[model samples]
Structures are given as C-alpha cells and as structure tokens.
Target: MALAQFAREYRTVRRAEGWGSLDGAYYRHLPFQDLTGRFTDIWRIRARSYHTFLHRVLAPLESLTGRPLNVVDLGAGSGWLGYRLARRGHWVAAVDLLDDVLDGLGAVRHYATPVRPLLAEFDHLPMPTGHLDLAVFNASFHYSTDYAKTLCETLRVLRKQGTLVILDSPMYRGPTSGMRMVQERQARFLAKYGFASDALPSEHFLTPARLDVLSTELGIAWRLHRPGLDWRSSLIRAIGGIRARREPAQFPVIVGTCPS
Candidate 1:
C-alpha cells in the first residue's frame, strides 16, 4: 500500500510539473470517486480538522438564521461539505468548475435534501441576486485571479445581511509578505515541475489590509478569525517542528456580512 501511494504521488507530481500527459489535471480533479480508497483516505486526514472548524463556524449562523439556509458553496470541489450541510436540512448549491467531480458526490443518494451541484466559476455565479443566505469558500477563494471582482460578485448574490465565509485559506499580515509567499510558491513549483508557473492554477493569499479596503469599498462589515489548533493540526505541527519564516496568521476564516 505504501509503495502504491508513493507511486501515485510521483505520478501526480509529474502531472503537476507538466512532465506527464495529465498536466495538473490529477490534482485539479481531487476528491473524485475513489474506488481504490487511497484518495478518500488522504482527503479524510486533510479535511478532518477543516470539518470541525467549519461546523464551529456554522453553528452560530444556523442558530441565528433559525431556519434552513439558502447556502452556496463556491468552489465546492467534490461537494462533501455541501452533502453534510444538505443532510442537516440546509438548501445547498455546490458550485465548481468541473461537472464530473460534482456529479460523483452522489448527493441525491446520500442525503434527504438534495445538494444542487452547479458548474460555475466564482466570479460569475449563476444564481439569483439577493437569494443566498450564506456563501462559503472553503479553501477556494485564493484560486481567484481577481479577488475584488469575486468579492463583489459574492456580495451581489447574497441577500441583505447575508454572510460570506472564507475558510482554510492562507492570510498574510501585509501585502509584502503575501507577495513574497506567492513568489516562493511559484518558484518551488517551477523548480519541481520545470514548467511555467502559470501551468498550475494561480493563487494569492489574502491580507488584512486588502480585506479592509474591500470591506470599506463594498460597505460590508468583516472580521478575521484564526482557528485554534486542534489535535490533528497539533500533531502535524509537532511532527514537522516548524518551517521557515511565516506570517503571524496562516489559515484564517474571514467572515463578512452584506449591509442591509
């Protein structure tokens, strides 16, 4: 099993670096149907902490709304989070770039409240204006090339006072640190893959200053929350024993509410 997993990772690396025909498609199509069980196992490990964090964030929103939420899960990947939310009786729309990935979720078979899997991009969500009670970008917001445009679109689709949550994505203290991290990631990718950095999807970390500007421009009140380290994360940190220099806050949950 270990050998097979190593082989799979090697192949994925090759694909990501453009050395193989897959050309980063393997990573892009993650959390897909995994009859072999390997993908699911990996996802379980990575997502466990995220799931707990998400539930904590959702609890207050659920209580405040006092009814099933009209929730849109932007960049929802395999839609597991949407499946869970749907099972809890919220009306969930799981939007992603890949239709096949969404279809594999089997939301209808698994949940009573069917999860609507929509193929769409973050900047141009195909939903009615002022309809969504909540919009969540779980580790997906950074993929946007234009963060401001995406935030504006998110606000447009949200109802008055609707909540927008950005979870499990990196946040920097300032623009300088954020740009430095971006360049470092690009450099690492180039070194490993021997391809143009753009071969992999573009991603940019958000900074508090940038968010503040966006919030003021859009007239939305926002707050940033750094998650407390859970057992899983703690164990990972202990094993790794810290890396190079990093911003004060890494993974953050940015919550914004559209003004009435």
Candidate 2:
C-alpha cells in the first residue's frame, strides 16, 4: 500500500518534470530511443551511460555464457532494459511500483518480447530464493529509503555468487557533498513545483562510505567502474567545479557479487 502511494506521487513528480511523456513508443525503444525537447541532452547522456553499462557490464557477462540468464530488473521504469534482456532470451522479471501505460510497467506492452511484469517494491521483491543470476537496480537504487534493507532483500533472492548492479545513481565522494546535492535538488523542486518532490524517504544519493557499509553487511565484494562522460559534459563539470569549488557526483557502474 505504502509502495503504491509513494510510486503514484513519484509519477506525479515525473509528470511535472516532463518525463511522463504521452509517447509510449519512445520509451519502449529505451537506450536506443531518440531524444526530444528540453531533456534531449540528458536523455543522450543516459543513452551513452547505458551503452557503457552494456559494454562494461552486460556484454562481458553475457559472453561468459551461451545460455539465457535468470535476471530481474528492479524499478524497471517503462520496462526498456527488461525488454532488452527478454528479447535476448534471458528469463526476466521486470518489477516496479508503477504500471501506468505511458511511463511505467504497463509500457512493457509496447515491446514485442515477453517480459514478466511484476508490480512490487524493490526492498520486498516477490521472487524466489536463490534463483536469480542477476538483479539490476537500473537507475533506481538511490530511491531506496533504506539501502541496507533493500540490498538484504535482494541478497536473499540471489543465487550464491549472483551479481547485483547499481547503475546510474549519483555517487559522491562523501556524504556531505551528497547531502548538498539532495538539498539543492529539493529546493529547486520546491520552488518550481510548490513541493520538494521527495514523496518518499529516499536516500537519493550514494557515497563510498555507504557502499562500504553495504559491502560489510551483505558480505559482498563490489567492483566500481566509472564509464567516461561526453566531452561537453566533462568540460561543463570541470567548469562547474571551478565555480562551485566542489566535486561533481559520479555515475559509476557498481557491481556487487553475492557470497558463495
């Protein structure tokens, strides 16, 4: 009940931000989807990052086997990545709280592949124990109000030595910087939308210390890989650092292995 309520509010904020575009076909194409309007550059960046995720993470893992993988996509907005996996013959469960046709799990119908859509919370995944080979929080982990609880729940469903991925979440060098980013974001949303857009008690960012704690508690070893940003983004971040005199948040593809 709480999950559904939080997701509906999140959807409202996303709609206000223009991400809930009515074009369902656009989202079905996913990382291969074309860009439009004010969010063009942002979508382009996301596409590039997703390709990096594919190259540095998925491709290599896929190469390791010829058989289909048992995979789960947590917070699978629009079911794009899940569709991609399902098309490749992997057994996939696409989980999310939103089932809206335009921008949520219901958009999975736009894809031809048979992706199993499950409307559920990430922390309390409706999956069998020790059955999944891969569990990916695609651009979604930072939305968790409790990272430890979420990961623990994920760990319970993962097979021994199964991999879990944290993709596209903003990771700062420290908690202070992360908090600043969160505050700034909240302020912008509050001013622009008459509310902070924090409909849930999400952590909203990540730090090394936080990751370290997860590693310790989950008994998992994490490998961090920072895929390169575009030259313009690189320059902009550099300029912003010079002016703001602070470290920019990074999107590192963080992969953690479940204990054997």
Candidate 3:
C-alpha cells in the first residue's frame, strides 16, 4: 500500500479505538452534505478564546486603516469574528467552504452582505484580485491541504498594502498529539486524486521561521507579535478596560503586509 493509504488505514483504526485526540467528526461529514450545525457547535465551544484573539488582533488594524476597513475572514468557520467585526462597523465578508455553514451564522449588522460561500478549493480561491484590505485566518489554516497554494491565493485577493493575519494556529501538534493523525488523514484524502504527498514539502504550513522567509521572498513586510498570553487585544470590544500583560510569552497574532 502507498504511504498515504497506509496512514489513512492506521488513522481510521486508531480513531475507531478512540486512540488519538483528532476528532473524527469531519472525516465522516465534511466536504459532503450540509454541516452548518456541526460548525456552529464547534465554534461555540471556543467562543471565549476567539473573542480574545479577535480583540487583540483586529484592534490595531482598525486604527491603521483609519476607518472601518474592508475585511475578509478567510476560512471563516461559523462566522464569529466576522459577526463581531461587522458589529463594530467594519465591512466584513465571511467566506467558507460550505454554503450551509455560512448561512448558519445568521444576521450580522454592518456587514456588506449575507455570508457568501467561496465554494472554490482553498488553494484556488475565487475572489477578485486586489480587493480586500485585511484577511484573517483564525485557527483555521490547517484545513488547507495546500499551504503554499492557499497562501498565494490569499495574497492574490489582497489589495496592495493590504494585511494578512493568522492567529492562534499551531504549525503542528494539536490536542492529544493529533499531528500524526492529521498527517495520516490528509494523505489519504489526497491520494485518490493522483497527488502524492511528497510533491511538496511538509513544512509548507506556516511556522514563525517559515513566515519570516515567505514574507521576504514574497516581498511582503511582516511582524511576529504575541500578546504575551495576557495582553489585551485592541481588536476586542474593550472589556473592563483591562491592561495588557507585562510578561513576554507566545501570543497569537502574526501580521504581514503586501507591498504596494
């Protein structure tokens, strides 16, 4: 058997026995029938964490843009951040793979329109060229099976001098050592299409080091800002006026700018 096939079988058997932390829910339901409810349930579980990330990350961009900005929440799961940003008076677009999932987010004030499904593959997203001012990947970058293609597609839709931000996503490693399971599953999913896993480097997923090099190669200026696990993000709704933490720690936001 091929390595990807082997990995898939191993993951299936492992998960059937409840061995890994990787949730098998998507393995069954995803890229299939409507999955709105499942997406909503998962996002609700992480609402607080999302709130913190949105506040810290969007706060500064809001200032830099000097007005309510044109923002796209790429891979926007359940539309939480888009909803929050729209409420704050920004023109937000919540794009996702499944139309039903985007529909599930419900009414969002100040948004340009109802949630729109991109429907295109992540690596080949179908947004118009040079339109969005800010694009965000909030803990959802891992789903793109082709990281480089996805990044290129993301950059394609960004306006000159625009910003692309990724937050709260680990390069690898997940709850219960799920990286191995993730690797196994993706390999299996891609094998039938005649695409071998070895065609690209496994390191395409964004890492701090990789992001640095990608920015330079792509001629984009970038910064690594971690709000120290406690720094209050200005992107949030400004709770109790809490002050940013003083200690240095790994925070979430990795902001980069497209050259004008």
| 1 or 3, greater by TM-score | 1
Write down the TM-score of every candidate: 0.73, 0.92, 0.57
Candidate 1: stretches off by over 4 Å: 1-56, 100-113, 197-203, 231-242
User: Can you write out model 2's per-residue Cα lDDT over 1-260, one digit (the tens) per residue?
Assistant: 55566776677778776674566567665675554464665666677777777788777778886678899999898888888888878999999888888678888877788889998988788888998989999889999999999999999999888889988899988887778778878897778767786768899999888889888987989988877777887777678666655678788889998899
Off by over 4 Å in 3: 1-56, 101-114, 172-205, 227-251
User: Cα lDDT of all candidates, in order?
Assistant: 0.66, 0.82, 0.54
Clashes of 3: 5
Model 3, 131-209: lDDT tens digits are: 7888887566655665556777888989888888876554422222234434554676456433334432333245556
Residue-level lDDT tens digits of model 1 in 1-260: 43233234434563453321122333333334334344454344435435554566677888888999999988775566677677788999988764432233322333445789886778889998999999999677887777778889999999998999887677767777667667776687567765334432444678777788887788879876655665766666445323535443367667887889
C-alpha lDDT (0 to 100) for residue 204 of candidate 3: 28
- Give the candidates in order of TM-score, highest first: 2, 1, 3
Q: Which ten residues in a row have the lowest lDDT in candidate 2?
A: 32-41
Assess the local accuracy of residue 83 in candidate 2 as a C-alpha lDDT between 0 and 100: 89
Error of 2 at 145 (Å): 1.2
Model 2, stretches more than 4 Å misplaced?
Answer: 1-5, 20-24, 239-245
